[model samples]
Target: VESATRTAIEAIRTGIGTKPETEIADATEAEAPVREVISLLGIIDGAESDILVPDADDKCPGGYFHCNTTAQCVPQRANCDGSVDCDDASDEVNCVNEVDAKYWDHLYRKQPFGRHDNLRIGECLWPNENFSCPCRGDEILCRFQQLTDIPERLPQHDLATLDLTGNNFETIHETFFSELPDVDSLVLKFCSIREIASHAFDRLADNPLRTLYMDDNKLPHLPEHFFPEGNQLSILILARNHLHHLKRSDFLNLQKLQELDLRGNRIGNFEAEVFARLPNLEVLYLNENHLKRLDPDRFPRTLLNLHTLSLAYNQIEDIAANTFPFPRLRYLFLAGNRLSHIRDETFCNLSNLQGLHLNENRIEGFDLEAFACLKNLSSLLLTGNRFQTLDSRVLKNLTSLDYIYFSWFHLCSAAMNVRVCDPHGDGISSKLHLLDNQILRGS
Candidate 1:
C-alpha cells in the first residue's frame, strides 16, 4: 500500500510539471479524488474495522456476541439471520427491539400459553416455515418425526404441551428442557428411554410441568432425585417399562403428585416408606407384576389420600392381617392370585372400601371375621375360587353388599340379601332362592 501511494504521488508531481498552462487547473482539481482512494485503503488495513479477533477469558470478545449462559460466540453478521446458533436459541430473540414490545402484548392478548382454560388438544397446523413441528394453540406436536434431539430453531413462545412421541431419546440429560419452563405436559411415549440423569428435571422445579408420560420405554430404574423436590408434577406414568425394583428414595418430596402408575413391571416387593412421602397420592397401580406376598409391615400407613390400589394378577399366596392399612381406600383389587386363606381383619382398616376383588384365586377357607369390618363394601367378587361351601354367618354382617359374585351357587347363600348374585343357577339354586341348593343348607 505504501509503495502504491508513493507511485501515485510521484506520478502526480510529474503531471503537474508536464501539464501546460491551460491543463494545470485540471490536475489540481484531481487531488481530492486521490485522497479518497488513500482513505479507503486505510479501512482495509484493520485501522477502522468493526470486527476484532478475540483473546480467551472474556465472555464475548470485541465484535462477537455471546450466546446467553453459554460460552459460544457468534459474529455480528449472524445475530438475526433467522438461524439458531445458540444452545438456548437466544440470538434470534429481541432482533427488532421496537417490535418486541408490541409482539409480547399481542401474544398475551391473542394466544396466551399455559392458560389451562384457553388450551385444548386438537389438530395441529404449521405456524410458519421456520418450525419443523406443527403447532396448534399452545401445543407443539413432533410425533413420529424420527428426531434424535429436540429441535433447536423453535419459535420463542411459551409452550404448554410438547409432544415428542416416537422419538429415540435413549437418555435425557440434566436441564434438557430448562429453556422451555412453561411446558405443562410432556409426552415421550415410545422414546426408548433407558437412562436419565439424576437432576434431569431439576430446572423444571419452578415451572408448572404437571404431567409426564414415559411409558413403553426401556428404563430399568430411575436415578435418585430424578424429579426435584417441591415440584408440582401431578401424574407420572412409567408403565410397561423394564423397571425391576423400587427404592424408598426414588420418590422423595413430590407432595403434589396425585397418581403413580407402575403397572406391568417386575417389582417383587415394596420397600418400606417407598410411597410414604407422597402425601397427596390418590391412585396407585401395580398390577401384573411379580409380587409374591403383601407384608403388612412393608406397606406404608401414611397414604391417607389413597383411594384406589390395584395389585391384581400377581403371585401373592397369602395376605397378612391388616395388609391394607389405608384409611381412605375405596377400591382394593387383589384378584387373580394364589391366595388360599383370608386372614381375620385383613381389610379392617379399609372400612371405607367400596369394591373388593378377590376372584380367580385358590381360596379354600376364610376366618369368620375376615371381612367383618368392611361394612361399606358394596361389591364383593369371590368367583373362581375353590370354596364349595362358605359359612353363612361369616358374611351376615355385611348389610351394604349390593352385588356379590361367586363361583358356586352354594356360596351365594353366604351373601344373605345381596341384590344381584352371579351364576344364576347351576342346575340347583336360583337367584331368588339361594338357600334352595342343598350344599348351602348343609353349611
Candidate 2:
C-alpha cells in the first residue's frame, strides 16, 4: 500500500513538471481536496489484469477484506476456507483448526478462524472486523447485527457517535459503554434489552456523551445511578419499555438532562423527590403510562426549567391542587385520561401556560374559576369529552385563546374571544349558530 501511494504521488509530480509554468502555478493555487486511488492498477496496454497492485490510500467497503500485500479486495467470507484467493495467500495463511473455529464462532465470529486486523472503510478504521460494522466519518453504525454483547474492540480514540440498534443484548452489564469514553451520542434502540446492571453507565461521569436512546426494549426498571454523577447527558429516551415504577435514586446524577422520555411504559407511580435532582429538565414525556394521580409529592418544586410535560393516554383519575410547580410551563397534555372534573385550583399555578390538552377524558363540568388563572393560554383542546354544557364565563379570562376544540358544535358558543373553534358544524349544526342536540338537552 505504501509503495502504491508513493507511485501515485510521483505520477502527479511528473505530470506537474510537464505542464506549463502558468498552468502549474494555477493548479498549486487551488485548494481542492484530492482522493488518491491506490488499488486495482491497469496494465500499460489499457487491459485489465489479474495482477493485484497494493495501494495504501485505497480501502475496501464493508463485508470485504483488504489484502495488504497485493491490494486485492476479496469477500470476507472467502477468508480461511483453505483456498489461495489472494496472490500472496494472505487469506489462508492464518487459518485456525476446525476444533478451535467452532469454539470461537460463538464468542468472536471473525477471530482465530480468520484475520483479526482492524476493519477499514473509507477513512474510518474500527478495531474489530467480526460484525462487519461500518464507520462513516466518526460514527460506527452497527445496527441490526443481532449482537448479543457489546462490541468490546472499539477504536482507542474517541468517537462522536455509535448506533447499535436492533441487537439482542438481554442484559446490559456494568461499564457497558466504557470502551468508547468520549462518544457523544449512543443509540441502542430496539435491542431487546431486559435488564441493565447497576453502575452500567458509571463510565459516563464527566464524559461528553450527550444523547442516549434505549427505547423499544424490555427494561422493567431503572437501576440505581443509571447515569453517573456529573455526566453531560442531554437527551435520554427510555420509551416503549416495561418500566413499572420509578425511584428517587434512579436519577441521582443526571443534573444536565434536558429531555426525559418515559412514554409507553408501565410506570404506575414514582417516589417523592424523584425528579428533584433534574433541575434542568425541560421536556418530560410520561404519556401512555399507568399513572393514576398527580400530586405535589410526586412532582416536586425543583422542576423550575420544565416547559413541556406530557401525561396523555395515562390512567390519571385525579390531579391534585398545585400539581404543576413549573413556573414557565408552556404546554401540558392530559388527553385520554379518566378525569371527570376540572377543579378551580387544578391549574392555578400555570399562569404562563400557552396550551392545555384535556381532550378524550370523562369531564362532566368545570368550576366557575377553572381557567381564571390561565390568562396566557392560547390553545385549549376539550374534544372527545362527556361535557354537555359549557358556560362562556368559565373561559372569559382566557383573552389570548387562539383555538379551542370540542366534540359538539354548540360548545363553540361558550368559547368567547377565541379566534378559531373546531367542529364548525357537524352534520346536525350550522356555522351561524350551534344546534343543541335534543338527546343532550333532554328533549
Candidate 3:
C-alpha cells in the first residue's frame, strides 16, 4: 500500500500526464451526462480516464468513487458486490451482504434504525419526538413493534418500501402519508387495519407508488376509488381479509394493475364491471371465496391478457358457457366446488388452457364435448368425483392430453349398500386404467 501511494505521489509530482480537468474536457462531449453503463475498462482500454470516475470539473455530481492509494475510481454500486476496486481494498472490507443492502443503504444516508432499542418493548417513537428522523428512507421496518398509530411527521420523502407488518394499527388515516409521499411500496399485513379513510392516498398517484399489500387485515369493505385511476400500480394484495363485496368503481383508477389477489375473502357477489377497469390484469386470485355461480354476464368484458384464474374452494354449482372470456388463459383452478355436472359448452371457450383442475368436486357426469375444444390442454384432474361411467369420446379430441387423473369404480352392490372396487374408495389395484382407452364401465 505504501509503495502504491509513493508511486501515485511520484506520478503527481512528475508532470508526465495532463491535468484531470483537461482530460475531462477532451473525453466527454462537453458534459453530456452519460445516464447508464458506467464501465471501468479504461484501465485496460487506455482511455482518457483511469476508471469510470466522475469528471473532476463537474459540480454537484450524482455519484462517484475514489481509491485511497492509486486514485482509481469505480461506480458507487460496485462497492460491495465482491470486488476490490480500491488499491487498499477499502470498498470490499466491512461490506454487508447484497441481500441486506436495504439496511446498509439506509445507514449510508444517515437514517436511523436502532435508536429505539432502549425504548419499552411495545412503545413507538413519533417523528422528531424521539430521534432526528421518523423512519428510514429506504425502508420503515417496524415489524412486530406493536405500533398503534402512524405518526404524521416523517423526516424523509423518497421512501422505497415502508413495512409495518405484525403491528396493531387498526385504521389508516389520510394524515398517515402527509410526510412520506414518495413511498413506492407499503406493506401492512397482520396490522389489523379495519378501515382506511377515504382518500388516504390522495397525492400518491403522482408519485411512484406501485404495490400495496394489506393481506391479513380486517377490512370488511373498501370505499370506491380506493386507489385513484391512472396510478400506474401493478400489483394489489388483499388476501386473507374479511372483504365481502366488490363494486365496479372499486378499481376505477388501477388501469395498469396486472395482478389482483382476493383469496380467503368472503366475497360472494360483485358487479359485472368488477374487473372492467383493469385491462392489463393478467393474474386474478379469487380462491376460497363464497362464489356460488359464474357466467358470461358476470364478466361484462373479456380479459384479453389474463393467463391464470383461480376460483377453487368456492360454492360454485353452475358454470355458464363462455364463463371466462380470456383467450390467453393457461391455468384454471375450479377444484373443491359443488358442481354436479359440467355442460357441453362449459369449457368450449378455453381453447388455450393448458391445465384444468376439477378435483374434489361433487361432479357426477360431464359431456365429452366440454373438453373437445381444449386442444392445448395437457393436464385434466377429476380426482375424487363420483363417476359411474366415462364417455368413449372423452379422449378423442385431447390430442395434447398428457395427464388425466380420475377415480375408477368397479361394482356398486345393493346388498353391501356400498361401492366395491372403487379405485380411490377401496384402495383396489385396477387391472385396466380408466383414462387410457376412453370408455369406463363398472362391473
Candidate 4:
C-alpha cells in the first residue's frame, strides 16, 4: 500500500509544481509503518524489485502521497487530503483546510483597534481613515483640527452624541454635516462659524437630532428654513450673535422648541408675530438691546406661556397699555431705560406677574390705578428714579408689595401731613423752613 501511495504521490507531484511545509512534516513521520503494512497486504506488486528512488531535486514537483489500503492509492493532493510526505516532490500542493471565521474576525478587530489613539482633531481637517473613538460608552467626540470645511464621510455609522466645538470654521456649509449618520445631540459652540449657508442644516431635518448649541459665533441672520422639516429639536442656544431683527418665520418651524437665548445684540424692534410661532417657548432673554418702545399689539397672545422676560439696559421710554401679552409671566425687568411714567393699564393683562422691576428710570409719579392690576405683585423695585413724593393712595392698592425703596424720594409733604393730623398732639408740630418749600427737621 505504501509503495502504491508513494507512486501516486510522485505522479501528483509531477502534475503540480510546489510542496507545502505542513505536508512534508506529516509524510516523514508516518512513512515506515505504512510501508510495512502495505507489504503484508500484498499491495506492493514490485516489492522484490529494487526500484531506485532519486533524491528530491530542485526541479521535482511537490504534492501529496496516496496509498493502496482500499483507501484508493490516489495522491493526497488530488483527493484534497491535508497531508504530504515523499521526498521526490509528492504530497505537497493543493491541500484544502477549513478556516475558522472567528480567527479572521479577531484579526480584523485588532488591526484597526489601536489606530484611534493617534487621532488629532481641530476644526476643518477630516480624518484620513473612517473610524470612531468611543467616549465613555457610545458617545463620539469628532472634532477636526483647524477644519474649515466639513468632512466627506463620518467616522461611525451609529453615533448618539457628537461634539464639534473649538474649530476654525467660518461658515457652515450645506454639505458640512453630510457624514453624521444617526446623531442625537450636536454641540457646535465656539467653532468660529461666522455665516450659515442657506439650508445648511437641511441634512439633519429628518434625523433624530434633539439638542443643538451654536452659541458664541458670528451669525448675523438665521434663514427662514434653517431647520429641517418636522424637526424634533427642543433646545437652541443662539446667544452672542450679530442678529438685529428676527422675522416671524425665524422660529416658525421649531414647533417643539422650548428655550432660546438671544441676549447681547442690537435688536431694536421685535414684531409680536415673531414669537407667535414658538408656542412652547417658556424662557426668553432679550437683555442688552437697543429697544426704545414696546408695542402692545406687537406681542403675540401665545406668549402667555412665557414665564420670564428680560429687557434690561435698553433705551426704552414707553410701554403701551397691555403691552405684556403674557398672562403667566412671573418675572419682568424694565430697568436701565428712560421711562418717565407707567400708564394705569400697563400691567392689566399680566394676571400672574409676581416680580416687576422699573429701576433706573425717570419716573416722577405713579397713579393709584397704575398698580391696581398687580394684585399678585410681590417684589417691586422703584429705585434710581426721580420720585420727589410718594402718593399714599398709590400704594394702597399694592397690598401684596413687601419691598419698597422710598429712600431717594424727598419726604416733605408726606411727613408734614402726618405731624399736623397727629391725634396724640403731645408737642410735635409741622415746622416749615422759609427757604423754598423745604420742611425743617425738628431740633
lDDT of 3 by residue, 175-266 (tens): 66656556677778899989988888666767677877888899998865487544768888888899999977777788788989898999
Per-residue lDDT, model 2, residue 262, is 89
Candidate 4 lDDT by residue in tens digits, 1-443: 64454445544545664356576456535554544533542233433211232234422112212322222223211232233333332333422211112212212223211324455332223324444432422345546556565444554545555666666878777787776667767767678777877787887777888778776688878875688778888777776678888887787677787777677777888788788888888777777778899876767898657887778778998888878878888778777889998777788877776777787899887766777777776556666888767766665565554334334323322322211111111122211111112222112
Query: What tens-digit string does per-residue lDDT give for candidate 1 at 362-398?
Result: 9998888888888988778888999889887778668
lDDT of all predictions: 0.71, 0.71, 0.64, 0.59
Q: What's model 3's lDDT at 153? A: 43
Residue 104, candidate 4: Cα error in Å is: 61
TM-score winner, 3 or 4 = 3
Tens digit per residue, CA lDDT, model 2, 1-443: 53343344335556543555575445433412111110211112222122343357776653345665877865433455445677788766645333222222322222110121343453464444443467755667777888876677554456776778888888889856656547878888899998899888878886788988888899988886577677899988888999998887888878889989888999998975788888899988888899999886778888889988889899999888788888999888888999999888689788998888898999999988888788888778898999979988888889887667789866766863454566643443221111123332232
Q: What's the TM-score of each model vs. the native? A: 0.67, 0.67, 0.61, 0.58
> Which portions of model 4 show Cα errors greater than 4 Å?
1-145, 149-161, 181-184, 405-443
Clashes of 2: 1
Clashing pairs in 1: none
> For candidate 1, what's the RMSD?
39.4
